[model samples]
Every structure is written in structure tokens, then in C-alpha cells.
Target: MKALVLAGGSGTRLRPITHTSAKQLVPVANKPVLFYGLEAIAEAGIHDVGIVVGETHAEIEAAVGDGSRFGLRVTYLRQEAPLGLAHAVLIARDYLGEDDFVMYLGDNFIVGGISDLVSSFEQDRPTARIMLTRVADPAQFGVAELDRNGRVVGLEEKPEVPKSDLALVGVFLFTAAAHEAVVELKPSWRGELEITDALQWLIDEGHRVEATVISGYWKDTGNVTDMLEANRLVLESVESRLDGEVDAASDLIGRVVVEEGASVTRSRIVGPVIVGAGTRVSNSYVGPFTSIGANCAIIDSEVEYSIILPKASISGARRIEASLIGHYAEVTPAPDTPKAHRLVLGDHSKVQISS
Candidate 1:
């Protein structure tokens, strides 16, 4: 089977950051979110992969070139616009050809991988198979309605009143039969061809649409809260490895990974935390679930549950929690004499002030 990975959405939700960097490229634990999906696809033993890319195609290509590094031969398919999932399939018709394939949303993070899902699809050979998980806000995702017998009976895209709380996960398995349904779809109210509509079309045409309700962790990683949660979840599995230099005055606690060339001096790091290569943590308290990217500087500050991008620096800040700092950004305390708040924020920026 082949794979189709969608890396092409303009992440408006993660604005400012997404304005400069692709949302899929956002680091969770110092690794890009899209890389996790690629690794999962490779683990599923699908080597022939097609990546659907949009305006940020150049960056995606640069990050994942040739795909050989990930044990797959990737072919980049250009999507001229931010259409819809069904539209992506429509454009990838040539690349997908007649082969059965899996469609993975690059921004989605799923624990336990998709190996079992691929194996099940290969054995059952359903016309289409969708992964579903119970979500608190069903209206924010494409939801499915199951019959009394637990069969998929209806599907809707971001319904005002969802029929069920079972939201569609980003992973999908489909046979060549899905192509016919995709071509016949009309634009939804949002002016894009919805994948849920195509699946409903397949169901109406008497094709078997299988649904699996997954119990494992699944997150979209589209917003800050979800990204931080995903980072925390992934950090839980990290093992303690200290290759970098740690001073005698510093204390390294459970499950911390200090990459080579990183240095910790007179600081307290409470894991699960990762200090990326060439980073320095001095006279600071690096708390749990925090990822400091390469070449960053953390001094005289207290940080917890945050992601610091590469080249970012935080010094003399009393407390930093549940935050996402961008690349090359700096965080410092305001002058006591002025006692004023100064922020040079971008569009769609949301800041919370604590007095």
C-alpha cells in the first residue's frame, strides 16, 4: 500500500508562528510534528509515499527531501490552493493511481502509530476505513454517527449539532473505489469539497465503510493547547540520557535528555525535559514537560510546560509557563522603574497577563 500525507494547510489558528513557519513544522519536544507522521508511515511498511503540499511546499520539501532518510520514496504533489481533504485526493489521483493508500494529516499526532490499522485494512480490504475517537468538542471535527449495531451510518463535517461525539481521526485507509466517490463531490457550504461528504457518498453507493473507534491518544496539534498537550504526552515516554555537560551545582531529575554540546550550570532541570544541542541552561529552573531547542539560552528564569524554539532566549523572567516561544525570540523582565507592559505582537496574537 502507498501513503498520502497532507502537509498543506495554512494554520491560521497558530498565527504569528504559523505566519513565519509551517504549522506542521512546529516542534514538539524539539522535533517537528510532521516528522512523527512520516515516521509512522514508514513504520507501517508503506515505502511509496506522496506528500500533498501547498504554499509552504518549499519548506516542507527542504525538511523532507527525497524521503529516503525516512525509508520511503516520496513524491511531492503540489496543491495550488487550500482546498479540502477530498480535493487533495482528487489532485493526487495520478500519484495514487489504482493502489490502495492511507491518508494521514501531517499535523495530527497519534500514539501507538498506525501499524495495526494498516494491517487490519490489508486483511479486511474494506472500501474505506476511518479511525474515530471520542472528543469533547465534536463540532470542531468531522463527526460520525453509528447505528445500533455499531456500524457507520452517517458522516458530517463540523456539524452545528453533532449526531455523536465520535470525531474522525486524521488517518484514513481507502481502496481505489474512493476515487470515483471523490470525483463526484460538490463543494460544501465552506466552499471546499469535504472528505466526509465523499465518505457519505461511498456509503450511499452500497460500498462498505468501516469505522474503528480508537481508545489510544489522538490530537490534532493545531492550536497551542493541543500542541503543548501533545508535547507532554510524547515526553512521557522519554528516557533519561545526559550526554551534555552538567555542572556540580546543577541537579538533573527524572527523564531528562541533554543532547550533545548542551550545558547545564547551577540550574535545576525537572524532567521530562529536553535541552537541545548547543543550548545552555544557567542559574535557572527548567521544569517538567519543557523542550528547549538548539542553541537557546535560558538564564535566571523559571520555565515549565513550555516549548522554546531554536535560537530563542529567556533570561531574568520570573516565570514562564504553558507558552510557545517562536524562533529567535527573546523573553526578559520589564524594568521595575517603568512598571509598564510592552509587547510587539503579531496578527491574531493572544496574550494573558497575570498581576
Candidate 2:
């Protein structure tokens, strides 16, 4: 079996940041989100891999050249336009010929990996197998309805009124039979050939379609909030190590990792947190669930539950929390002014002022 990773999409939700960088390359715990998926594929023992890339193909190629670093031989397949998930499979037919393959979304984060799921698919050889998870907002995702016997009987893409609360996770397993289903599918009302439609076609044709409900953590890191949450989740598991220099004036508390070449002076870092390589934290407070990327500088500020990208700086700010700061950005105190209110008086003007 081979692996197909979909790394092509314009991440409009993460604007400004995605405007400059690929969404899949966004870091979670200082590691790109795409790297996790690549590691999982390598762990599954699938070395012949194909990556589907869009116009931002160069960035993906530069990061994952030849895939030899990840123990996989990669073939890059370009998609001129992101028509849909089914369209990706349609274009990758030659690379995926005759072999069963697993499709993983590059920006999706699935904790505990997919080794077990791949093992199960290889054993049963279903026409298609989809991972499902119970979500409160089923309308936001492709939903599935199961019969009384726990068999998937119906599927819909972003339905207005979902029949079930089970939402489709980003991982999919498909056999060679799925190629025929892709050809038979028509574009949806949205003008894109959704993968959900292809799986539905397989079911309509009496081909075996299975669903595996995942109990582990899974997140589609499409927006800023989810990305920060993913960063926190991964950082929570990091082991504390003092690989960098710390002055006697600095105090470290609980599970903090200071990477090599990083320096901390006249600051207090309360962990479960990480200070990336070459980053400097001085005269500041580094609180929990915060990750400072490589070569950043934090001075005279207090930050908690935030992610600061590389080469960024935060100074003279009192406090910042739950923020996703972009690369090379700067945050400093606003210029101060007199406290007294200034108002221009007019003839017979009615006004109320609070003291």
C-alpha cells in the first residue's frame, strides 16, 4: 500500500499568516503540522508516497524534498486547481495505480497516529474506510449516518440538518476499487467533486464501505484558535531540559525546556513551556502553555497561552494571552497620554462626564 498526502489548499481561514506561509507548514510545538502526518505514514511502513500539492507547491517541495529524510520515496503530483478531494484522487490515479492507499490531510492533527487503522484496513481490504468522530457541530463537516447495526448507511457533505452527529475525520483508506467510483462521480452543487460524494457512490454501488469511530484526539487545524490549541496539546507532553544558559537571576519552574543557544536572564519561566533554540527571554514572565519559536526575543512583558513565531519581539506589554502572533511581528506598549479627558465646548451643548 502507498500513502497520499493532500497538502494543497489556500488556507483562507488563517489569513495574514496563511497569506505569507502555507497552512500545513504552521508549527505545532515548533514542528510543522505536515511533519506529524509524514511521520505517521512512515510508521505505517508505506514508503512509496505521493503528495498532492497546489500552487503553493514550491514551499511543500522545499520542506519535504525527496521524502528520503522520512524514510519514504515521494512523488509530487501537481493540481492546477483544488477542484475537490475526489479531484485529487482523480489526478493521482497513475501514482496510486492498483495499490491500496491511505489519504491524509496535511493540516489535520490526529493524536495516537493511524498505525492501527492502517493495520485494520490491510486485514479487511474494504472498498473504502473512513474515520469518524462525534462532534457537536456536525454541519461543519461531512457527516455519516449509521444503521442500527453500526453500519454506515448514509453520508452527506456539510448538511443543514445532519441525521447523525458523527463527523468525518480527515484520514481515509481506499482500495483500487475507489478509482472507479471517482470516475463515476459528478461535481457537487459547490462545483467541486467532494470525496464524500465518491464514498457515497461506492455505497450506492453495493461496494463495502466501513466507518471507524476514533476515540483519540483529532483536530482540523484550519483556524487560529485550533492551531493554538494544537500547539498547547503537543507542548504539554514535552520533557523539561535545560540545554541552554540560564543566569542566576533567572528562576525556572516545572517542566520547562530551554533549547541549546537559548538564554534566560532576570526572568521567571513557569512550565510546561518551551523556549526554542537561540531565543532569549529576559526580564519577563514566561507562563504555562506558551511556545516561543526559534530566534525570538521576549523582554519586559508577560505572556501566557500564546505562540510567538520566529524573529518576533514582545516588549513593554503588560500581558498577552491566548494569541497566535505571526512571524517577525512586534508587540510593544502604546504611547501614553494624559489621563484627563479633553473636550471642545460648544454653546449650550449637553454632556455627561464620568469622574
Q: Against the hidden reference, what TM-scores do the models get?
A: 0.95, 0.93
lDDT of 2 by residue, 1-355 (tens): 9999999998888776777778898888888899999999999888999999997899999999999999999999999998999999999999999999999999999999999999999898889899999999999999998888777788999999999999999999999998998999888988899999999888999988898999888999998788889988998899999999999999999889999999999999998899999999999998898888899888887888877777777776567777777777776555453222222112122222221
Candidate 2, pairs of clashing residues = none
Distance from true location, Cα of 44 in model 1, Å: 0.9
Q: Model 2 compared with the native: what TM-score?
A: 0.93
Runs off by more than 4 Å, candidate 2: 336-355
Best by TM-score: 1
Candidate 1: what lDDT?
A: 0.91
List the RMSD of every prediction in angstroms: 2.9, 7.4
lDDT of 1 by residue, 9-58 (tens): 99998877888788899999999999999999999999999999999999
Q: Give the TM-score of candidate 1.
A: 0.95
The models' CA-based lDDT, in order, is 0.91, 0.87
